[model samples]
Target: MVKLSLCAIVKDEEACIGRCLDSVKEVVDEIVILDTGSRDRTVEIARDYGAQIEHYQWNDDFAAARNAALQYVTGDWVLVLDADEILHPEIVPQLQEAIASDRHLAINLVRQEIGAKQSPYSLVSRLFRPLPGIQFSRPYHALIDDSVTEFMAQQPDRWDIGYLSSVAIVHDGYRPEAIAARDKLSRIRKAMERYLSEHPDDAYTCSKLGALYVQNGEIEAGLKLLRKGLKQEKHLDRLLRYELHYHAGIALSKQQKVGKAKSHYEAAIALNILPALKIGAYNNLGNLYMQTGDLTGAIAAYERVWQIDPNLPIAHFNLGLALKEKGKLNEAIAAYHHAIELDPTYAEAYQNIAVILLKNGKVFESLDHFRKAIALYERRDSPAGSELRSTLKEMGFKI
Candidate 1:
């Protein structure tokens, strides 16, 4: 029975820290939190969970703060987690069982970006043994030292790191406006500045920095770094290529290089990597065609997704929109209906169908759909329902 130390470093995470700690409290032996000047109630919430808290000074060095937190771990194995991350309740026993078994030294629990369902973006080193030499490296995006990397590489077969299927780390890092796209870019730039200063020729850092630039709306600079990284690195990671192509496509599209953007998007789809990545590529293609006033092309791209996954409500909704734009009102209505069938709680599809009904002079039917949409949206606590309700009222529909 191997004991576990769940370690984390956080700052100003009052909105979500309690949720994170609560999720994994029962699974670990000790909870160690390193706070870096949080003015919010993050520290108080952590205290409520009986977490051992230590104040770490703000130094723009993540690895340093994390290493300091590691010193408090009494467990043989350490489990690292971010402030906004939580493990799914069902997989708790599976994780404990894995740690107890004599199969592997470390386990790579899939880090899933929330709202994306089961699509895991990265295999973060979340669980590992607390060996003396297994020190972390890199100041910003630091990972375990080269010795661990080399050890893993040497015994690729025997030095096993099993990926637990039933387990997942759901990260809600993108939930708030403070940590959204713009803010993400700002943090990435700071991290990139430190990383690039030390390792100028590193492909991973270059690719990541390029992606940050793209998110920040620096199209030319982003393209320059991506292209340079692709050209300079001989054997680029295929996974990295998927992200590079996706971001590069967005940059090209922003630059009005529609043809080039489409080419990159096509290349991404051709990779046949993760299904989420495939869906993203197809969505981008639909968007590109929508921007170009090629309604038929947009419909075709979205429709392709339906063939691959008919139950995907977003695909059906997007297809309906494209069809409606092309004046295929009957087909569009059918598409929206399919979307609603796929997801009974899909407010957007109901609203879209209502709009189409109103356009076709079916005022009574439109009112009914709008009511349904409003009901679903309100139940889900969405602001969009207010506008929908107002529209219904203005149209003389009895609420």
Candidate 2:
């Protein structure tokens, strides 16, 4: 069996560092952590796990940090993991077996992006032989160096790089809400500053920079950058174009450029089958129509979301609201019910259904759902629950 070295670079990751180590502690022969100036007890916690810790200075380059971490690998193979990622228990055995095989030089594992989708999935190279000359590339979206490809090309007999379906890194990297978006924006800001400085005329860089701007709440700047990027790229990257168009629509709608936003949304939908992007585009279009007092158009857009993905709770819930505003009480109730079925834990859907029932003079049914929603929200201490409780009492609810 090939010995595995689990390598990671971290800084001030005390909150999630332990969980990350615990998941793969038993699977690897050695754990190496490269800390870049952590003010927190990130180093102390890592040391408690028996991890060999090394310190590196922050260089504003992810590849530099990653390569620094790689230098400590004493095992035959290296498994790259982040401080917020964990290998699922079922995936551990598969990774062990894959590395043991002489036929395989690398394994591409799935990195599930949580909360982005009802169920999200993405793949990346996470395991590889730590042989001489194998290095990582790219400063921001760091990719494995071309050396691995060149090695395989020369060997010709090396037909062994494979994707492991059973192996996945359960990424909690985007969870708990407080830091996920903030961290992403922070990194984007750094990357943008570097990328723009080096490649001023690069359209892709501009587009990504624009996305970061939008994410950071600079909507006007984001729109300008994205439009400039779009002009340069034309229609080369359809999915990216779709994304830019969608965000442009959102920013425009927020700026009250409703007509321009509508055109962008329509263009995005007319293009292709990027499910997440399409869903977002349609959902935003529905919102735009609702704001313009076009309840019928809003309902139409939302219904398209249902046609695309029936189990999506947000689309169903929003569709129900649009229908309710149009006075289609029966259909609205049905949509709400469907939303509830898709996500029984969804408090907002339950509350909305209760409101619809109360409006229709079904006070008893409304009271029951309101109580249930309150209970659900209380369990999580959601701020939305407090308002729900207030509304329930106003409708003559006992508690």
Candidate 3:
């Protein structure tokens, strides 16, 4: 039997710690909770789950607290998780079998940080590992991949890393409500800015800070940092360099700089990083091409996205728009229907379809779809609903 230690560094996680523990209690042999001065009942909740608790003072450094919990891990392998994350209940036996087989010293499991049940993005990494010499580094957004790689290089016999695609950990820590409640983004930027002040040329640090700035609506400032980071050659983390380029391209696209955005997207795509990110770059590149009146280029880019994941409503809807612009109404309508099938409440798809119907003189069907689109938009209190309502009144429809 393989010993697996579930290690976590938590603060005030009263609302979510129990669910986090309950989800993994059956999977781990030992639970080690290191609290960094929680004013709530976070420690009490962990104690109910039979966790060995330790307390550490808040030092404003995440890596220091993480390393403290690591010292108490007695198992051969450590699975690090956050209080706002939950392991899929069904993946436990699979996890046990994988670790027992000892096929790899490190495992990359899917970490899905869900925005909603409908749209969840995934990140996979070496979250489950044997911490022989690897310790989380940096103060704010800490990382351990470099140290892990260095450790694995010396242990040639166990240099292999396994991937568990089925075992997903759902992280709810970065939800908008959660971030606003704690003013988390401001604090994150503070720590990241401090790190970059000392190591200005560090690609990964600049990339991360750039991304946060873009998220907070600082376009020019974020783009400058990302472009500068891309030119730097000091960091051994080539994979993160690709991520920075992707973000830089996004910032450019957001500012409607099509040519520059296309260049960076092309650069990131060429690196062939993760499949999802690869498709994302292509999708955004396609949108840029479409915006620049390159319908052929847009179609090709959207086709690539559909090839990777055919059910993405945004890709299908975009493909429909591009097809409609190219004078392929039948195919456009088909694509729109496909998009609607994937997501029933796709208001844009309904509105687009209704516009096409009106163009074709299908009055009754068009009115029906217009009503659906209006209902959806009105529920969200957006400008589209008002415009549609005004259009209907102009067309002599009863209010």
CA RMSD per model (angstroms): 4.5, 5.1, 3.0
lDDT of 1 by residue, 1-399 (tens): 678889999988888888898888888889999999999999999999999999989787777788888888899788898888997788788888777766566776756565542122455667877766566766655666354666767667666666575436878775445467437656658877688878877766777788778867877888888887777544765656776777778789888999999998887777745454466678888989998999988998898777756766778889998999999999998999998898898888898898898898998898889889999999988988988788667877776
Report the C-alpha lDDT of model 3 over 199-318, residue by residue, as the tens digit: 887777788899889978999899888888878734545467677878988898888887888888888778744565466687778888888899999999888888766867777898
Residue runs of model 2 more than 4 Å from their true location after superposition: 1-4, 26-29, 39-41, 47-50, 74-77, 90-110, 115-167, 175-177, 180-188, 231-246, 256-345, 374-398
Q: Please give the RMSD of candidate 1 to the true structure.
A: 4.5
On lDDT, the candidate that comes out on top is: 3
Task: List clashing residue pairs in candidate 2.
Answer: none
Candidates sorted by lDDT, descending order?
A: 3, 2, 1
Reference-based TM-score of each model: 0.78, 0.71, 0.87
Ranking by TM-score: 3, 1, 2
Q: Top TM-score: which candidate number?
A: 3
At residue 291, give the lDDT of candidate 3: 83
Over 4 Å off, model 3:
89-94, 101-103, 116-122, 165-167, 233-235
Model 3: lDDT of residue 151: 85
What does the lDDT come to for candidate 2?
0.79
Residue 171: error of model 2 in Å? 3.2
Scanning candidate 2 in windows of ten residues, the lowest lDDT window is 114-123
TM-score result, candidate 2: 0.71
